[model samples]
Target: MFHVFCLGFLCCSMVFGILLPVYESYKAVKTKDVRQYLRWMMYWIVFGLFMCAETFTDIFLGFWFPFYYEIKVAAVFWLLSPTTKGSSFLYRKFVHPAFEKREPEIDEMISQTKERGYNTIVNFGSRSVAYATQVILQTAVKCLKT
Candidate 1:
């Protein structure tokens, strides 16, 4: 019974999350209006964060809380609600400020990570080629001997 209720709430959240965004996105494209685009951007950022949190917490608290899905769906609705404009409020009050403060640090970390990843991939590629060449040469020598 609890699982069934959770499923229903999940379906409702999906409908709100997917359908409403697509509709708003189409309007944004058709109108080519900056405000509409900004509104959707705010919605996406909050919704995305909510999804990441839900994914991590659901395993631990999903079944424990009876109101979990109910709250999840409600939160999604709040984020997308035009009258409430919860997303914009949250972004302005919290998300934007936090990100703005950390932007430089984040940029530096990202650059370092990218450089490390590139170096690792290059090292792996060179090592793989060398190993392959060694195997090929050894096989050729063995075949020639036989």
Candidate 2:
């Protein structure tokens, strides 16, 4: 059973990591279509977030539920199928609504952070590093003296 699971895992890794990218790249290059690329990106982003949520759900429900894997497989099918619009429904019902409410505040924070400028960030980072180095040196010296 363990060997079979390992083999299936390896096969999935190869298909997703290697074959899928190659196929997507070929399609992108052959079509030379920006919309296709954007659609692909959108699908992957939605799928990634869905996977995260699914993982947490699995962690919580898996031990007690014998049919968890079947449910997850069905969910993957629902999410990937355009006819179902699962991804769009999730985005519209959850993500978009949340972000819409916070958009103004997020934009304000971004502008404020940008206004601080590059030099300010550089100086802050340098100061932090110097402080850390000083602390480490003092600790070493104290250890040696002891």
Using TM-score as the measure, which candidate wins? Answer: 1
Model 1 alpha-carbon drift over 4 Å, by segment: none
Tens digits of per-residue lDDT for model 2, 31-60: 988866754555565667766776687578
Would you estimate the TM-scores of all the predictions?
0.90, 0.52
Which pairs, if any, clash in model 1?
Answer: none
Q: Report the lDDT of model 2 for residue 41.
A: 57
- Colliding residue pairs in candidate 2: none
lDDT of 1 by residue, 1-146 (tens): 88887788778877898787989888997999999999998888888888898898899988897688788888888888899999999999999999999999999999999999999999999999999999999999999999
Error of 2 at 43 (Å): 1.6
